[model samples]
Target: MDVDVFVAAHRQEWDRLAQLLRRGRRLSGAETDELVSLYQRTATHLSQLQSWAPDPAVVNRLTTLVARARSVVVGTRRATWRDALHYFTAGFPAACYRTRAWWVPTALVFILATAGIGAWIAGSPEVQASIGAPDELREMTRPGGGYESYYSSSPAAAFSFQVWTNNMVVAGISLTLGVFLGIPVLWVLLQNAMNVGTGVGLMAAADRLDVFLGLILPHGLLELTAVFIAAGVGLRLGWTVIDPGRLTRGAALAREGRAALGMVIGLTLILLISGLIEGLVTPSSLPTWARIGIGVAVETAFLAYVLILGRRAVRAGETGDVTAGDREDELPVAA
Candidate 1:
């Protein structure tokens, strides 16, 4: 029970463990074995101190040393190429599939709202005037006008980067601000919907609806879907605060927040694809049908990824959260 004597005896071993840890991925086999042995012995020493001597300073030092030594002995897993492969093929798609209920309806509602507003604007001069002056609307809808020129105004590469950055910010906002009851998420989507409606109304009024569809559809399908997914995940996070069901509010938020973050990473990649299409394909000389076809193909592939791979992932019990080993340990609570 003599803390000083015990410390004197184990100090050298503790120092050795620290030295091995400092070596960091460069340990020889013998040093690795020694580190494991030292970790176990140090852990026992910590236990004894807590049980008998309980010197706070010594105990804390040993605690930290043992933890570091343990990590060195066990080693952390590096992300391999295989890990990246599995994430995209399985993890990301599974996450999307699991959230289908949220995002699918989101897409539908947004589409309906946009369609109604667009139709109203196209049909009514008053509605159109409320948006802008007649001359402004005329310029926006002209064959070589604002709506069409906006995409090609910048060089394609710069435009793609700008679009990607902007979309990422919007998605980031939807995910991060969902903690505020999702009001921001709704507002963001509504703002976007209005923009779409205004464009549709303006173009249709000028008999350029064909040009609008051809230009927009080529990238809008995938681009808009990514936005809808971001909004849905954000709203879901907000709802978790209100009704966590069996979980404590904190636990539910953590779970859904992690899933929402995963969506953020996945959506970044998805939005990049859409950005490329918007910059390159949308402004290309290719026929409207070809551009639209490319968009349709990409959108369809994404849907299939979610429906087929995602369903399989869900069936296999994937919840789109971090893998069990990476997740913090959940304490048991009585049901």
Candidate 2:
């Protein structure tokens, strides 16, 4: 087919389609019908031109035009503030609520493990010796030593940004690694637990457990909660691999994977808040109780947000998954 002859035949139709796209007016029913018809014909014309070697530049222009028209015909979903609003208010919370069975027990196990490790380390002199030299351990655990000094070591603003970046990285990894059947998630949790336990044990042995608690509790409660939620959601994602229930493993993985990604957004913000508390409140001159109270209050509000709002969202059928219109359409399978 002569490219020029083909172009001449369809130039009017292509121009009209381009005109309609540029106009961006509300298409009347008839106009909408015309637009669809024009898009289909133009698509076919481009295909014919491409089958024979058409002018490269013309092919490019047609390619762009076809893509734009396709968007108009298919209807693009532009994200608005309302979408973000819905994500936080409904999607994130519902996801958290639905996965509470996984995360709540996760939180319990982590706490128990942390406490047990702390107690064991505190009770055993041999454990303390294995941790570090006596002088180094004392220097860190002593009141006003490395334990307290670490928080105020850097400027508050810089420190907070650093903490936020670090925690977000950990949470991101925890959520993404869930495809491995949650073993890595468990390792992530265990590493954190051991670190927390070691700190508590060292401080308790030094008779400065109160000071350690004061520094950590201010941010640790919320910070650790965010971590646990990431771990639990990741675990759930990995579990989808093992037991997909009604859905095929791939389908279940896709569903839960999307939800885990959404959880990352929520956890990022949660970790940010905790980072602020660590940088600002924990290191501030506020009394220990006041600092701890702030942490507790913030943590309480977060939990309430997840439980109350999430429960309601779930009840309303929010799955923390993207809306039906937003997600990819699935092909039907033989039952």
Of the candidates shown, which would achieve the greatest TM-score relative to the real structure?
A: 2
lDDT of 1 by residue, 1-335 (tens): 78999999989988887877784358778877887888887877776776667798997898788767666555677878997777787788888887778889999999999999889989999888988887888888888799999989999999999999999998998988987899999999999999898889889888999999999998899999889888888888888889998876766898889888877778999999999999999999999999999999999999998889889988998888877656543434222
lDDT of 2 by residue, 46-155 (tens): 66565555688778877788888877777788889999999999999999889889889999999999999999999999999999999999889877889899999999
Q: How many pairs of residues collide in model 2? A: 0
TM-score of each: 0.78, 0.80
Specify the poorest-scoring 10-residue window by lDDT in model 2: 326-335
Clashes of each: 0, 0
Residue pairs clashing, model 1: none
Location of the lowest summed lDDT over 10 successive residues in candidate 1: 326-335
